[model samples]
Target: MKTKRFSLRTLLLTAVLTVVLTAGVLLGAAWLLLGRAGVSMAETMVLINTLFVGEHDIQTATDQALDSLITGLGDRWSYYMDADSYQQQIQRRSNSYVGIGVTVTYLEEGVLHIEAVTAGGPAETAGLQAGEEITAVDGTALTAENISEATSLIQGEEGTQVTLTVRGTDGTEREVTVTRSQIDESPAEGELLSDGTGLVTIRNFNSRCAEDAIAAVDSLVEQGAQRLVFDVRNNGGGYVSELTDLLDHLLPEGTIFRQRSNFGWETTVTSDAQCVELPMAVLVNGNTYSAAEFFAAQLQEMDWGVIVGEPTFGKGFSQQTFPLASGGAVNLSTARYFTGEGVSLIGTGLTLDQEVALTEEQAAALSAGTLDPSEDPQLQAAIELLRETEEPS
Candidate 1:
């Protein structure tokens, strides 16, 4: 006799389980937000009533709940674009969205920090600068949940207008009116270092990034680059395929990674023929994540090179995009990935061989030329790693 097919109840339980484990919400508003699609509060209470009967089976009920909810939405990207997805999107595209172009992030103080103002964009055109506090957008309080929504609200068709209520670093608050328009985001930037080390900062990994990076590397190599410092600072991450193709040039032909799903199934992604075996150092910090971590992990795993600076942001889950009838998508973590050496960088990030920390004052000092990159602990450590492994010219 064969086993019976999974029921809708089972599907909903699976979804609930996935959401609870992934988001770690046990109850209250967070739980309501997570399971609002299908499982009503009453239904949840009913399931809780059965907790005693379903001991080990509680997980099945939760997963099934989540499955039912997800199936109803029918969206692929609309489910929840977690931090990892946000990082990937930012680093994958060079084309800036149309809006009062400003990079805003939540700081430790719970205030919206004006991280960057793209030059020539509406925000900069309206005199918006970095280090300002965005208090509100059209009078709505700015919060982490609404940050993306506010940005989207500001972005509109070309020739649109947006008013921002911002408080400067001096605690002065005011409203500024600005028109929205297209802003360009550059992907690949390269500079020649003093020691003939080509320093390339690939801000994103969009389409054609592999070619762009190769060209940049070739230009640096031609410029007498004996070593390379690939700076991915503040880089969130992007296309896994793009990163894999890039690693093809940086890692030897072999299994680079493995992806395991909820069902305990595994798939391996291997490297291509071409590989770069130069003296290289990858710079990562608390923000270097997703595909960035992927590159760093494999490089460190194979002992091909060194990963310096600080621990990575550690986003090891893989999302599968499913399209919805509403022209939206739901991108959920369908699988977890590991390095060739079985290192998990999920909640735990990549451990750099050399650890370094930076103070605000030190960063300012470095920016003002009082400190040097060669003297910066992180850079110095990376240089030392590269020098120690250098090949005789």
Candidate 2:
């Protein structure tokens, strides 16, 4: 057998072809098992852009891609916001904004309903009230699709005016022009009840929540409040640091909550030496969630307070916002938190010492400010509970 000697050039070509084939096979395997062997996000993005058929600018495409990526995580707490929405979120977290300071919700009736009006804000100053429906913004009809646009229309440079057509609960409609200005919302409000119980309603745990809470509690104490009722009914929750700080003022030196991340890293937030020693009760409802739920759970776990009202909203996951280079942001569910006693409030919320459910009619009447406290079984129950503690045993 005559062995044909291959030339150096042919051998080199054959070796190069072998190397290329091997690399292709490895890459194919990697692409098949991309979840195990992570693929580069940049590479995926390039592939997406090359194949996407929708009409999208680079920014919109990237934003949508990021949003879709987060949505794929299948966690409701994880979300993506565009630049404008991200800025609005930051403003909300800061408890300050240059808008009319009215939070609105789109109703099924194609009306923009004012959910809450910031105290001393342009909306409140303009006599806007919660539950009022906004029909139009500056002559433009506000639909569910364009409610966000209407919100943008309402917000402008300080000193600018935005006209809103509002319908009152009594079916009266009128147009009011409100001048936008900087509004600072207090995170907590407190007052001493007639029975010497301090009623502190925490709006949300923003950055200034702890400070506001301290001031409110101190003021209530100065007004001769002997006990406290923390009303976190509608509070959806905010920064974890703010919650921890507020807890430090209320709880003695102990672990407030424990956070466990996906990587198995655990963190325990502890209270400081300073604490508010008043006998307390926490008021909660279906809207009470996240840090608010954590607050009630911690207090109940420590035997510091009696929890009242219905079961909580049961949000145990903690979210973290990551700012993108495009000025947008992504909020991701980074961890799940538990009470100091190792109780998780994810789906099954904290059971209250007293469970009181408000009838739909009563709730509607309460929202309309027509339901008397005498008829509000939940509030009455809390007051009775606290007052019983006040009475001599």
Candidate 3:
């Protein structure tokens, strides 16, 4: 009866082992397909438990194994997220965060510059205004190199208070304390320049980004925008749906996006007939990525606009989030994307029609959101090209 019980226990362990497979791939396929690889993850796991050195939890070992496997794929854009981290990532993608009611940018002066104060939010209540620099947060001096650290210093549980040292544009400094709250902020914004050119800056392509970008452009036209400049500098891309939708808003009837997956699947997204038809340009920088780079490429390729600034740091892969049986997920690069012209942007990013480099001071001011439109060389270059493109009216 003891021998019978051992055999039953082994069968149960082998059955349970298959649960460790993620995306319904990897180990199970390894066990069945090589005609098998990993020499049976079950056998490996059982051996680790019975003979491996040191303390190890089976669940943790499984998680690490999956993590390592994904990391081994050598795609910097892909990775595994544990359940808690995955939830946090989802919250970030939703474009909401717990913070004082202010939007900030890291200046080259090693401080955070207040770009916009949310009306009636904690920061505004504490008298924080746009153009002020956050010199320090909770006594830790803010720095461009550690923007994330400074951001974390200021954010806390809702109703918690954080102290900040702020400097106004005039150089006057003061310390203020403000309570934090949940803030839903979209970084996409539009402003009509003094010369009637609409300036739309999209910092991210997440959440309601498509809606926000479309609205910004339409509102600018309503305000008598004679031309348009889209600033996507420092933009790291987000959802594909958002990118395509925004492209549809700006580009006339044509293919806006093309993609191919590992399984030999291909697809394309086309825009409608209606589109914004103003003289336009897309401002980009090296930090521009993924959908942002593609946005500029499509415009330049279709003769709708010119690209200004340094070439984009190209991204050819599109990722898909695959949930693991482990309750976490892996963001795997599942598809290769191409420009609207069916050109890949992997090694060669979008070529700039005008390669405008920022001066040290100009870059600092740009980061602080304090750079005047009249003072930005890249914007000026784009405006010049657009002026040449303007029809006699």
Q: For this target, which candidate reaches the highest lDDT against the unseen true structure?
A: 3
Give every collision pair in model 2: none
For each of the candidates, give the backbone clash count.
Answer: 30, 0, 1
- Which lDDT tens digits does candidate 1 get at residues 1-393? 997599889999999999988666455655566566334645765768765564465544544454565656653322533333443354336455556777776754435677777667788889987778877777777776666455556656778787788888788999998898777666566778787777767666666666677778778878888888777766777677777777777788888888899899998888876776578888788777777778777887887767887776678787666544333345676888888767788667887888887787655443332446666777677877898888775
Off by over 4 Å in 2: 1-41, 47-55, 359-376, 390-393
Stretches of candidate 1 above 4 Å error? 1-95, 107-111, 139-148, 206-208, 263-265, 361-376, 391-393
Pick the winner on lDDT between candidates 2 and 3: 3
Q: CA RMSD for every model?
A: 11.8, 5.7, 6.8
Deviation of model 3 at 132, angstroms: 12
| Alpha-carbon deviation at 179 in model 2, angstroms | 1.1
Determine which window of 10 residues in candidate 3 has minimal summed lDDT: 33-42
How do the residues 1-393 of candidate 2 rate in per-residue lDDT, one tens digit apiece? 987699889999999999999999988887887754257876767776899787768888788878898899898889999998899899889988789887677787668877677767788899999888999988998786776567677778999999989999899999999999998888898877676778888989987998999899999988888889888877889999989888888898888989999999999988877888788998888888888888889988888889999887678899999998999999999998988777898788988989998998776654444556567788778888877776574
Candidate 2 has a TM-score of 0.84
lDDT of 1 at 388: 82
> Per-candidate TM vs. native?
0.70, 0.84, 0.76
Over 82-137, each residue of candidate 3 has an lDDT whose tens digit, in order, gives 76557657867888877787767777868887866776678888988887889988
lDDT of each: 0.70, 0.84, 0.85
